[model samples]
Target chain A: MSTLIGVDWGTSSLRAARLDAAGEVLEERSLPRGILTVPAGGFPAVFDEACGDWMREPGALALLCGMAGSRQGWVEAPYAGCPAGFADVAAQLTWIEPGRIALVPGLTCHEHGVPDVMRGEETQVFGALELLGLQSALLVLPGTHSKWVRVIDGGIDRFATFMTGECYGLLRQHSILARMMPAGDGELDAAAFVQGVHHARRSGTLLHAAFSARTLALFERLAPAAVPSYLSGLVIGEELRVQDLRGTLSVAVIGAQALTCRYELALATLGVTVTRVGSQATWRGLRAIASTLQGTS
Target chain B: MSTLIGVDWGTSSLRAARLDAAGEVLEERSLPRGILTVPAGGFPAVFDEACGDWMREPGALALLCGMAGSRQGWVEAPYAGCPAGFADVAAQLTWIEPGRIALVPGLTCHEHGVPDVMRGEETQVFGALELLGLQSALLVLPGTHSKWVRVIDGGIDRFATFMTGECYGLLRQHSILARMMPAGDGELDAAAFVQGVHHARRSGTLLHAAFSARTLALFERLAPAAVPSYLSGLVIGEELRVQDLRGTLSVAVIGAQALTCRYELALATLGVTVTRVGSQATWRGLRAIASTLQGTS
Candidate 1:
């Protein structure tokens, strides 16, 4: 049995975890050195600084995911089309150091002639599946860009991406709606948020629904403090509104607590059960793929 | 008959018209002096700079609309509730001067307890009515905040606002989708724009539809020059998707050419007749309101 170094490198940050052959966490590190900050021809140095020691160990393999596989990252790893499984992803790795370090390819799924792509998230999806011990599940990973995924027979069948969080930040900070909101962040107001979620149901579309944040403030019906919560509810609710959650017994939500919690509440309101998976899914996902590469490496 | 000065002062720009008793445009001036750019206690001075000479004439009445009546503008004119007519708006005018000058009040409509407010658009709706000579009509004013107005019996019955333009700008310039797009403005690609509108119909929601801008570009299905047009189509299509345009015979689109032309195309694609009214509607609407103030002033 050999060690594995798992790297989840995204647009904004880089994270790494070292796992023993048993897939137990041994050591971990996180840094703001995301792929975007790395200058051209500098990913090798950054990679060395992050986990050169771990890679020096005999027969220790490294698997990198997320934007690190993007065209602008260390090396461009072509996307694996869905329905892809662990073996499918493992077989497509772009080896940085032959048989040692490789970039895990992202996933691309086509819908209505348009291509939807995901980098590190595909790994998180696989990790959630591994942790929850489910060969098939419905999953929603909410973030700057939220992905609603479908897993069938132990592989990713198809998925959709929604710019819910990015839209929220843009409206909350840059749009006219921001004028009525307070400068800094506010705690999530449950009641206001629920009201927002309900409003989204009746408001027809987000383009129209988002305007309520302003009117709600102007009429003194929503406090300055609760505007953010309400806005969050609108976007999150809209995200859920477009999803065909019927017959969806339970959805595995993989993301940070703050975001998944909002999805949990919205889904619960719609009578859908939710299971949460955290950042660990990224490691477990990388390890799962790395495990498949065992002996072959 | 008394002379009339019609001023449309909004957040980003100011325009004024000196009209004869017959509602003919005698003189006109446009400046970059929007309410947002005006210094504190500077509305009166800026107003003077734009149309002071026109106002100095004996018995010349001024009716200013748009953000000039907003809380942060010249004077905080209370919004007139729908179903409000010309008379209702005229009655609520915030008098900057007893009889010589006044700020036209905006209109507010309620839907399921949430409020939708509009300032300058109200004037444009009335002006569109005057130009089209229709006592009842459905009009859409496309801008930063697009308004879908319903006028019945020569009054604003009810309206809804969609953040279509603002959302398009935010996504095209600030979001991840921007990364795939070219810098600066691009010419409207009719084919790409139409494809986007059709795609929006199938995408279900703008949140999901917008991602296609990137995906379409990534797959090389959409060119960089056409990304903006595609995005614009997505938002505008979404805006129209939520509206109950079933019973409408024709929509009066009042806006600048670049915007109204797009709306014209989208609405036309939906098999709805579109009647475009230019910015002159503001002056015509104000003149119509001033005609009623003739003897009283």
Candidate 2:
């Protein structure tokens, strides 16, 4: 029985998991070494440092996902076009050490002549599906770039990326709205956040809605501490506002607890139920892909 | 026949015009000394430096507009509630040297319990109306914060502020999309820009439409030099999208030529006509208010 060392290496951080043959995680480790921080040609060294011991084990197969497979990573794994299933993705893995180490080719889909690509979230989507036991579902992986994905018949149908998280960070830190917010992170003011969500619907566009963060504070209506929460709600709410959530019963929220919680609240406000999934989806997803590749080999 | 020193002082730069009794420009001067750059109690010095010679003249009353009236500027100029015209704005002016130096009280309007205020744009809105000699029209002042104003019966009825410019600067300079764009300002790619404008409508929200700027580049569909123009179109297009341009035949675009030209192209794409107005609207606006104040005195 071969052990699988699955890694979810994104732009800012890396997480690795060692799973047994049954796809159960036996141990896991997280590091600050996201692809961006890794020095040029240092990916192999960082990978070794992350799970060198696990790699030393005979019959150990490794699967890496996320920005690690991007153009800037160790090796560029070309994106697999959408409507891709576990088998489809497994077949497209770019091998680093043939028959031992491989990288997952992220998924891309086109709409109206524009291409939308996801490096790591595709793996998590499949994992979320398997964990939730759903053949088709709408999954939202909210992060720096929030992905609204659709799964049908155990494959990623199509997805859209909203720069919600990144925009929020820019507005909170670099934009004029930052001047109205407190110096550091503040407690999420639930009421203010809800107000922002609702305001987004009324404000009509994020470009206009974002300014409310400043005006609300300027008028003494929203406290400076609550500005961050309000701004978060505005961006999140804008992200949700564009999607046609009508008749959709529930959405699977994937990411860390803090981020997922915010999405959950925002979704709940719009009368949509949410199923929470942890980062374990990444490991589970890589495990599924590895298992499929193993069977094919 | 008294002369008026009309100042358009904003966050980044200050422009002052010494106008004769006929409102014709006698002398014009612009400095890097904006409200933000003016040190504590230094506005007077900077103001003097900008137009001290003009201010030294007997009966040279001064009318200042823009951020100079904000809480952070020379003195906090409380916003005058809207439906403000030349007379209304003149009445609310905060006097610095009683009847000699006054700051134009910018306009504020409320909708759905949210307040939208403009410090500098209100002046431009009035000036745009006066410049075009129209009692009622839809005017757009595009800049760091774009304003869509509806003029009715020669008064500033109500307006909405879109943080389009500021958001564009933040995204172009700080966001991930910046990585794909060339380091310096790129020439406007007319075709790519038009595509971006049209894409904004299809993408449904700026949050989503912005990601296309990256994906299009990643796929090599959009040139690196064209990214900035495309982004400019996306934000400007989104600003135009939310407005009910149904019956608006023509929109008076008041701003710098570079910005107004972009707005003109975008508005033209949407089947609306645009009349370009210059920054002179600020001076004209203040002159009108000063003239109104002089008549009353």
Indicate which candidate wins on DockQ. Answer: 2
Worst 10 residues of 1 chain B by lDDT: B288-297
What DockQ does each listed candidate score?
0.84, 0.91
For the predicted complex of model 2, DockQ is 0.91
Q: Which stretches of candidate 2 lie over 4 Å from their true place?
A: none
Across A68-135, the per-residue lDDT of candidate 1 in tens digits comes to 99888999999999999877987898999988999999999988768999998889998889899999
Q: How high is the lDDT of residue A40 in model 2? A: 95
Candidate 1: C-alpha lDDT: 0.88
Q: Give the TM-score of candidate 1.
A: 0.97
- iRMS, candidate 2, in Å: value is 0.6
